[model samples]
Target: MNTMTLWHITGWEFAALAFAALLVGFSKTAVSGANTVSLAIFAAVLPARASTGVLLPILIAGDLLAVATYRRHAHWPTLWRLFPAVAAGVVVGTVFLLWADDAVVRTSIGAILLLMAAVTVWRRRTADKEEEPESVTTRPGRLKARSYGVLGGFTTMVANAGGPVMSMYLLSAGFRKLGFLGTSAFFFLIVNVSKLPFSAGLGLIDGRSLLLDLALVAFVVPGALFGKWAVHRINQRLFEQLVIAATVVGGLQLLLP
Candidate 1:
């Protein structure tokens, strides 16, 4: 396999990646689904498979920041209910990765992004109607959790694009702002951390990737800080619309020849 070194990246490419890294942190702290744009940017800048490897560490860094900020608000019961199915889905995703080539992976990531964006839009339309929070103890709730867990695990493992899916689930469960951020914080941190070995074994994460991550990680901190500050002040509807638009553009770019 060819190794990507800093020398291989031009100044413009580095700038693009740095901006994407910033978005990763911003997404983690403020808008959970917004990172789909970051995912697209990374994949467009790097090889599809290698992009996942490189982006993983940056995401983990953002997750750390998110956990630090929202750790106390996490709903552990919800997490527990989602884990087993997520693990199963991860296993299946790993198998798929083992067989898929770059084209397949790129196409898969594009389709997942578009699908997630559609789900987000649909969820948002019905958001006001879900007055009561969904419960995991009930049969219907358990089924919903299992289905989302599997899909989240698969999409995350494939492209690190599980945020929108998870966001939709939490919203449907009637999570308010802080609760949504807190739960997603811990969820991605644990899941992304667990994925390290798999990514390494798959030759996605390597010395070269780490080198790129080192350069990109610093930008995440400031973005996180900005997101923390802006979360309360920003226009929520406008931001969501922007996120959806960016995700759609990214997905389309990946799908087109």
Candidate 2:
């Protein structure tokens, strides 16, 4: 394995990486859907093939902070329901990664992101037609769970963009306020942790990746702290709107030729 030098990181690149790190922290704490932007920024700054490896550790660091802040809020049932399907999808994605061209992966990620954004917007419109529920539902319908579980698993495994997919599913299923946050945190924590062995097996977690992660870790702390503060103040409708818009833009960028 060769050492990755600081020379690869020009001032602008460093700024991009730092900004991405901050977004990672914020996304982990406040809105899981914003990870699409962080994914795009990281891939832009690093080799597309190596970006996932480089970003995973930094994400895990941010995950730890999120879990600490929102552990008690997680909806364990939803997490459990999504686990098996997600694991299977991760295995399938790992196999695909072993042979897929970088361009194919990028295009697939972009397409999926665009698809998810459309679904989210459409779902929101449909939800608006229904009366405001007196209570939130934690148990997603079986068919809905399976649909989201498969898509979330495939997207997250391939591009680390499953947040939007799952967010749409949960939103459509009618989780509100803390239930949404809790379910998202638990789902991602399990999915991200599950990805470790696959990432290592694919040679994505080398020393160079670790060194880069170390540099990015500092930025996550402040970003997460800010996200924690922001989550409480932001209205649920406004937050979802912002997340959808971000996802649409990130997906298009990834798809660019």
Candidate 3:
């Protein structure tokens, strides 16, 4: 089904989608991986494929708000290092999408989230004992960026689930709190908006999805505002942990039922 059909959903579904949209903004601004919750919700409420289409615009909108708030602090050099690999990954993901039906897309996202979350948690635990990996910055440079970039691109393109992957990389690279949010906000703004053509070509986005996006768009404002306030007040360690936990739960939900 196309975007036009989403209007037939019930009021309860609207409520659920609206809340998911709110989380989109909050996650984009304050807690990056919290978006796994919104992704899971969208996949559950709509088919995995169509949900991806409908959710992209909403994510882009949140990205814009985040960029408006954090754009000044973005680390552009890091982005340049990663974009080439990310573009390659997007091509691979588009190929995957061509062959995947709903079940394949669903399972792929669920598995990716679970694996990435585990990696993040393990890296965090071991970070104190070892020097941060050079895989994300300096030294190994090209090889490391390509590795993370491909994974990040593939995951983001498939399920918009790249946040956790990037979060782990950025943390290991020792980005300060503001730098992390700013880099992420802009990275996704460019990336998500870039996906529009591929998504449209795949027939994943259209009038129906756009309509759903517009209706739920306003809810993102309050969520984004709350995120901005909380980011300044919350402890960084606590926020990162919460994002990981939420991602794990969301991954489990998708894999289970």
TM-score of each: 0.88, 0.92, 0.91
**After superposing candidate 2, which stretches have Cα over 4 Å from the reference?**
1-7, 128-135
Compared with the true structure, the alpha-carbon lDDT of candidate 1 equals 0.81
Can you give the lDDT of residue 66 in candidate 1?
99
lDDT of 1 by residue, 16-127 (tens): 9999999999999988878878887887778778889999999999999999998877888899999998888788889999888878876886787688778868867865
The digit string of per-residue lDDT tens for model 2 on 1-257 reads: 12374337898998899999999899888877787888888888777767887787778788888888877767677777878777777877888898898799989878987887898788778654543342356456777777778878887877787887887777777766566776677677768888888887787787777877888899999999999999889887887787777788778888986
The TM-score, computed over Cα atoms with residue i paired to residue i, of candidate 2 is 0.92
lDDT of 3 at 256: 73
| Most accurate candidate by TM-score | 2
> Candidate 2: what lDDT?
0.79
- Displacement of the residue 95 alpha carbon in candidate 3, Å: 0.7
lDDT for each candidate structure: 0.81, 0.79, 0.81
Cα lDDT tens digits, model 3, 1-257, are 55655776889988999999999999888988888888888887887788888899999999999999998878889998888988988898999988877677667767877887787677678765443322223332577678878988988888787887777667656666677898889899988888999999989888768878899899898899999998988776777777778778767876776
User: How many backbone clashes does every candidate have?
Assistant: 0, 0, 3
